[model samples]
Target: MYKGYFGLKESPFSIAPNPRFLFMSERHKEALAHLSYGLGETGGFALLTGEVGTGKTTISRRLMEQLPENTQAAFILNPTLSSQELLATICDELKIRYRKTGATLKTLTDKIYEKLNKNHQAKLNTLLIIDEAQHLAPEVLEQLRLLTNLETDTKKLLQVILIGQPELKQLLQRRDLRQLAQRITARYHLLPLTKGEVGHYIQHRLSVAQCDRMLFERAAVAEIHRISQGIPRIINLLCERSLTNAYCSNNALVTKKIVLLSAQEALGDEYQATFWWQHKAVKALAASAVFAVIVSSSYFLGQLYGENISEKSALNITAPAVNQVVSDTSSPAIIVADNEKIPDENAAKAITDNTAKVFKIESDGDKKRAVEQRIVKTDKPASIPMPVENSAEQLSNLADSKLAEDKATSKVKEKLSVKAVDGVSDDLLALFQSAIDDTEQDPQFKNSANQVVTPEVNAPALSDMPAWVQSDLPSLSFEQHIYTSEGESWVKVNGRDRYQGDTISEELVLNYIYAQKVILTFKGQQFSLPALSSW
Candidate 1:
């Protein structure tokens, strides 16, 4: 519902593991790098462990998509089966044909070895990736270790990658699994994103959805981050429900109220405290109230002047003295009132006087300097004659005060600007303006620039377009030049490439670009399938 209202092409906050929406934080990137190392020419077992929903699976899928042309990969998502069943699954994934009726362990091992050797001879490397390996029995794990032993003098014939939750680390710590653990050449544990990363993660998803970044309020983002603890899966869950609540209400943008409702519903009773405490607006209000009280009280005590107040009356309020001043001979002395029958206000003023006395009393070098400055300033009465030839001093004081006032005003303006721009964008604001105009206009035929353009193109508009355009056509923007088959082809993005390719169509070039960039995932699995690129 909100997608239509907000002009989003898809639900950006869906909880499903969609590779297209994967965003690898710094920690997730390190995990990917470790897995990639294992899959490289220098080969061995690569171990990755993390909490559930931390994106290991997505990372694994991304790595699979990035595998070289001469590399074959098999993924086993479940590893809890018996040794024979596990072996059979691996064989199936590897496309190794074997008679199942009398398939003994020895026979299966031989077949796997034969297949690996054949692949090796064919100049191809094979990678076996096992997920949820924490559930693998010791026997099954031992068998997996044995597979790694199949090797030539040059390098191992097979590369194995094991991924699982943190429990997998404990599982590996078992004495029986020591040998297996020692064989792991590369290991990394994917950590949940930091609080700062959670904000970026939300924006990344919103950008992918093509929605207004302001879809989530600042308070809502904080609530989601606190409750999710920066875990990608949890963030997905909270964001999805929050969006759904907004959708049901037909609201284009998510607000703090909607987030609260969604949190109460989706997180149940577990995250009540976090949901409340992490609200940014609530925090700001609390801080503001505290600051207001402090400033008001400090101002009331630090400055005083009145029309009909006697010295005794002046001494009755908690206001600083206008005439009494400190001297250089002052020590750290406690002030005592001679009259115990003083008025209540006067008693309060005495307390303030005690504080001032304490301020004047110097106990050390820095304190002495500060106290001297205070004495010098407070000693001058407002009625005192202006010193001869002191105009420059007065001007300097005025300039400093004005500069302070300017800085404070600038800070307030900056804060207001930041709040306004928090998650808002020009495009979104224009779209909202157009929506309001359409609402006001009867015909709803507003031809504003904010209108969403349909993806389909009219054939007439492309009548002059060439069939075999140059690879570097103005319409195509790609880093490198590449060639593709005559039929439709897609660009595959990986990473930044300074080099260029030649003789490529726009569509093929796009596919290459997409393929080169890796998608984010959980536990090395692709979080979302990529959208098919337009040809």
Candidate 2:
């Protein structure tokens, strides 16, 4: 259909075995050389094997064309026959007469030997080429090997060429066929075309079809090679479909897009569907792993630095008192004078706050101690008169309170020193430093300075609030939500359906769709739009 449209005399990519369209790659040339050498030498068996559609038959055809005029070749296109039937077919190919009704194995063999002997005397070589030799039965193959045994000391009477797929190689390796395998003097395995050769192959076929100009783009040729895996038959199928599609679309040249579509058509729905799902699964798994790593790292850094900051704040508030006690044990009078200068209620509250910040205390016992300390330190004695019997109790309580205060201060100093030492450890310090550096270098942190740091599970729903929450952005309205059912999710933005992971515009893109939320990037800002449904 497209031959005239593309200015071609014939279909360039027909799967038919045409010698004019054959592209002799390096491997093909080497395979021919092996076959030629095997036939020239006094050989028992010559072997040529390759994968399906790798030009094995083309090589065989070329070999036949180059045979010497003195050679009498018998081609067997089918090898599914009994030993006697095979010999009868050979006799028929050689024009040897035999009884049609009562042709037994002995009769066929004697006739073949007589024919071979006659050919030998006439200085004519007998070559038997069996196509699809892999399907030959063990007994039939053994019988054929036995025929080769009827040779003179100088040369074999019969030369056989076995050509088939890669299975033929395995077939020859059986223990039962070891004797026959030892007689194989020459063998060559043909490989598929290289990437560079695929281009030349297409061009060669196009030239044979009488087209002068290049019809396929370079990238299209590359895509063909990639999809077809350099197999000639598959390449032919894809190129043929691609050209047909281009011709139908009225395209002047075949492009990569056309080739892709053509491949999907030619390779069938099962392959395309399987490849599509596998690609998606791999991408999703990789994305999930990266997300997990980032989230885990961020959470760890937050916890580590949060504790460091809280401890630093506590140290700043209590460092002066700790230093005062450590510097002078004889300055107890000076400490008491400093304590008395502050108002009783204010001093007690400061002490209680410091203790609460350091120890996270929740008991009423600690608060009662603060109140008693305040009462004893108050300057106005006339405003709060004490009973005569409780005055001695107050004195004893004051002494006990003083001892407790000293012990508590010493404990706080010890804890602070220990924490300071721990904070300066090599591993801990390195961890804290790395966390700080990562935060400073993070691209998201630089872009959104005031962005809230929250866990994924605690992400807020978009629909529960107004479209634009800030009062400054009352006019800007862009609403998007996710709808999920049966394990798939879709994004709907302002009444327009958008596929996930595709860019809506230059400034807006649907990044991902989770079960509970859809992540989007709008004008350099990322938003996690929650799903309207529960799941």
Look at candidate 1 and tell me the lDDT of residue 391: 51
Task: Estimate, for each residue in 332-366, the C-alpha lDDT of model 1 and write its tens digit.
Answer: 43222332222222111223432332233335855
What lDDT would candidate 2 get against the real structure?
0.70
Give a tens-digit lDDT track for model 2, residues 348-425.
232542121111223485463222222122222222122234547867998999787567645433432312354367
Q: Candidate 2, 156: how far from true, in Å?
A: 1.3
TM-score of 2: 0.57
Task: Give the whole-model CA lDDT for all candidates, comma-separated.
Answer: 0.63, 0.70
The number of clashing residue pairs in each candidate reads: 44, 0
